[model samples]
Target: MCRLFAITSELPCSPMTAITALDVMKEGHDGSGVGLFMTDLAGPWEEFKGAPILSGIFTNKGLKQLDHYMMELGFTTKYKLSIKLPKAPPPGVPKRDVYLIRAYDYPESWEGLSQEEVNHRLMMIRLQLRQMGLDTGDMVVFSFWPDVIMIKEIGDPMTVAEYLGLDRKELRARVIMAQGRQNTNYAINLYACHPFFIQGIATMTNGENTAFVPIREFLESRGFPGYIGYQSDSEVFTHILHYMYYKLGFGIEMYKHLITPLQDRDLECHPNGSFLRHIKHTCRRLTIDGPNCVIGVLPDKTMFMVQDRKKLRPGVVGGKPGMWAFSSEICGLDAAIPDRDKSKDFQPMYLDTAVVGSDRKEVKIWRQTEPLPLQL
Candidate 1:
């Protein structure tokens, strides 16, 4: 089993808050790896909020090639932030040549393109660079998007945090998700880490994904360029979300319905049972079969959690004013928000979709509708 921790704050906060929570749940996950994803970034990143920031590691030569390539493509660096760490790498952690967070201006030709077009372009660039990095084995482009950054390493969560100098880095964000991954589905590959991202959607899971093959096949069939990698079965969750919302036009709440469709009797109790029934029949192949708990974020900063139909995984949601925390263990939340309102804490069952809106200002729980009391 693995441990997942995520928090969204109305104010900017460091990844330490979530890292500390992970420490509390340390026993649940072995010290195999750590992965983090942040959005609505703050601190020194505030000024570059609208610019696309490319986060990655590069060798000395790779950095030069990267700069030359970006220049050739008409991109110019507006700001650059390098995470300064010791020359000597930490024990068991892979040595990084260069840790960079760079903001860039799009090519002149893309100046007036629609946001959708720009997003597609970013995805294409990231995919190309990622494949290039794979071939060279000297650079890794984790993410390239506006106000989003992903960092993954092979080490204990706390140790990776210290090695990265996270506390002194001054990197802060309104939303952050981290996972202390205990690899069971794949070897200890860096790309297999949690907090997977494609475009603006991000997700991390704490349990196995028995339903991965079909889901991967389905997403790949969509002809989306970003759907090729499946280093980890959990990656499918993020694509599932991207497909449901961006492609099919379903609202976030409907994600739970699509992933775990209700039984026929329960489906008939829904207010819009007719519409849902059609979706179930048409998208049946997309349903997930696993004992998993999924936590994810959308481009709009909305954070949500859902569990498989069996509810085999442990998940709890807790919050106070201006903040909400989700974790695989209640103790993890307790450690993060010691003064939180325990009365407001709740565990999501199989059919619940718990959402924390942008800035953590709103909390909502959408439960599956059940049959009304018989007209006796």
Candidate 2:
């Protein structure tokens, strides 16, 4: 099993809070790797709000290739930041070339396109870079989006943080998601890390995805170019979210139904039973099975947590003042936001969607049996 920690706030916050929470749940994960994804960026990153930011690790040769390619594609780097770790590599750690975060100008041809079209182009670029990395063996592009950054590496979460100088650096955001991967399904691959992102939706899971194969096939059959990679079964969580919100145009609450649809007997108790029954039958392959808890954030910054109908994984949701937290364990929450109201905290059970608005001020419990308003 692995541990997941995610927090969203109206105010600028530090990633260290979530990292500390991961430390508290250290026993649940062996730290085979750690994946960090942050959005609504703060500190220095706040200045580049509307521009596209590209983040990844690169080697000298790969860096040159990236620069030439970007220039050819009519992209110019507006600003860039790179962190240099100690030259002496950790004993078992593979040598890293350079870690970078760069803000870039969108291609000239993309200037007049719709915002959605521009975003699609950016995703295509990221996918192209991903293929470039696989071929070159000298670069790894983690993310390319406005106001978002992803850093993933092998090692204990704390050690990885120290290596990146996370605390000393001024990296901060309104939303942060971190996961300490335990490596149950596949060999440790950096791309296989948690906190997977595609388009704008992001998700990380804390348990096995027993329904992954069918889910992958269903998604890939859609013919979306971006659906090709599935290094980890959990990657499907983010894709499932993308499919529901982006492709099917369903509201967030419907996402819970598609993943953990109620049986006919249970559906009969709901006012929207007919519509839901059709959804269940139509998207049966999208349903997830077995023990799993998912924490995800949509493009709008709305955050959510959900448990499988079996409620096999532990999860707790809590909030106070300016923030909300979702974790696999209460200890993790207590570690991140000790002042939060413990009494008001709720643990989402089977088929419950704990949805928190982007502002982090409004939270709602959307259950499988509840009828979703047509307006939402």
Lowest lDDT sum, 10 consecutive residues, model 1, at: 367-376
lDDT of 1 by residue, 13-46 (tens): 8898889899989998998999889989987778
Once superposed on the true structure, which residue ranges of model 1 sit more than 4 Å away at CA? 370-376
Estimate the TM-score of every prediction: 0.96, 0.97
The C-alpha lDDT values of all candidates are 0.87, 0.87
Candidate 1, pairs of clashing residues? none
Ten residues in sequence with the least summed lDDT for candidate 2: 88-97
lDDT of 1 at 231: 92
Candidate 2 segments exceeding 4 Å error: none
